[model samples]
Target: MPEGPEIRRAGDRISRALVDKEIVKSNFYYVRIKDREEIVKNKNIKEITTRGKAMLIRFKNGWTMYSHNQLYGRWTVNLNTTKIKSTRALRVVFKTKKHTVRLWSATDIDLLPTSEEHEHSFLKKIGPDVLNESCSYKLIEERLTSKTFHKKKASTLMLDQTVFAGLGNYLRSEILFDAKIHPDDRPFDLDKTRITQWAKSIKNISHLAYKTGGFTVSKYIADRNKENGEPRKSYRHAVFMRYQYECLNCKSRIERKWYGKRKLDFCPSCQIQTGKIKPSR
Candidate 1:
């Protein structure tokens, strides 16, 4: 699934390309989009912004278009001078005087109100977005320390969008590994200092992911183009695929295990499994 950074980048692209222009044409693929014709025919795009992993395209008349590109969804922007291929599976198309933007295979494409009440109501249900500039550290700390917090494994909690939006399986593992925290450690068991450190690391990684256009881990390697270098595979396969591969840090054997339904990889010596660190008061 695309994480927060990827969505943010998409918003930036869409906003820059389509914000001021009037929508001359619009089209839809699936019937799931409510009032598709009304939205395309009447609404004028006011702005494009991202909330968590979702993208919102606000219109002048108060309606907003919301989209979440689950896994396969992708967008392509072509200048008016360029040619665009014709395809029936193309979900949503927005044509401007200067450019044409097409969204394909989007899991979500819906029209909604842009009212303050509606926006607040929607945001109220979600936790702080990791990539949002205004995301509060206090809120994150409070959420991490709240009563409902069980000592659930950090890996599992990170994937819970309710705990912190924008994190996926790959980011979860990488962030925990970067902070030198074991994926299996319970949230409450972590000291305040460790929790704060993890939160800051998440912000940094999220920014890096956005800047690199969705390529997270493999972007760090010095030689991404070596003759023997294969594009680092998806996060799951990159980390968990080679069970006996040497750890990049300590040269220890990387290990894998089934944590719930998902596979997780970690260095045994680096990520200590026991949650016995002294709490900072």
Candidate 2:
């Protein structure tokens, strides 16, 4: 799944490529949108913005096209000044004077009301966007400390978009591992200092990932050659896909468990479970 950083990067790229440009043609595949003909035939892209994992492309005339890439969806910006054959799998294509932007296999494509009332109605349901500068630490702290979240596993809570937006599976695992907190541990059992530290780390790492375009285990990989360096192999084997490999920190064997059909990898020595905790209401 594409996380917050990837979504933010896509937004930045699309904005740079299409902002202020008049659309010459718009095409859709696998989706039949009402009023799409009116939307595509004549309109200019005003701005592009992201909300959680979704992208919003605003038009000059109060129409906003929303899309969520989900897992396999991708977009490509064509600038070679050569016409290529359009594929039937293409979901949406926006052509401008300078570039052609093609969206392929997106899970969602919708037209939305552009009014603040409509926008707020949708935004209010989601938690703080990790990439938004205006997101408050107080809000995150309050939400995590609430009675409703007390006994729930921190891992499960992190996956809830209402608690924190822009966190995907890999990020949740990495954040918990960095905090030295077990995924199944109860949120309230965590000390206030640790909880605050975890939140801060999440924000910092999120920023880094956003700046870097995406999070890979490579960022944590150590490079030995200062002159002409190559990333150390051990760093590449961290919590992501290295299921049974030895833990880089403690040398203990890494373990894997199924959590709601998702594979979670963690080091047994590095992350010790406190005990079985009751689920939050």
* Best-matching candidate per lDDT: 2
Q: Summarize candidate 1's per-residue lDDT along 17-55 as a digit string, tens digits.
A: 788787787766667774565765535688988878878
lDDT of 2 by residue, 181-200 (tens): 78888768887887786677
Tell me the spans in candidate 2 whose CA falls farther than 4 Å from its real position: 80-88, 116-124, 216-237, 275-281
**Residue pairs whose backbone atoms clash in candidate 2:** none
* Model 1 lowest lDDT segment of ten: 222-231
